[model samples]
Target: MAISEKELLEAGFSNRDVDTLLERLSATGGTMQGFIAALSRRFR
Candidate 1:
């Protein structure tokens, strides 16, 4: 994904949370859709 820290902040995640999300992205094979799906798993 081509996301920046600025974009992540603008999306409402804190700096610390952005790192966590980035790590999650890596764990899920680094696709934005994979990231969203991982997040969905958390809320479900």
Candidate 2:
């Protein structure tokens, strides 16, 4: 199932933040592990 933009918005992120996160994820070559690690560090 695909996640919709409305779902993201409902999760409390603005469109710009979501877009930026998507851009960063794409720039990382779609590596979910690295993304999760980065997010962990960020939230910590």
Number of clashes in every candidate structure?
Answer: 0, 0
Candidate 1 stretches greater than 4 Å from native:
33-44
Let me know the TM-score candidate 2 reaches against the reference structure: 0.54
Error of 2 at 39 (Å): 4.4
After the best TM-score superposition of candidate 2, give how far the Cα of residue 37 lies from its true spot, in angstroms.
7.9
User: Lowest-scoring 10 consecutive residues by lDDT in candidate 2?
Assistant: 30-39
What C-alpha lDDT, on a 0 to 100 scale, does residue 22 get in candidate 2? 79
Stretches > 4 Å off in candidate 2 = 1-4, 31-44
Q: Compared with the true structure, what per-residue lDDT tens digits does model 1 show for residues 1-44?
A: 55577887998989899888778778867876666667779999
Cα lDDT tens digits, model 2, 1-44, are 45556776897989997788778878877754566576679998
Measured by TM-score, the strongest candidate is 2
lDDT of 1: 0.77
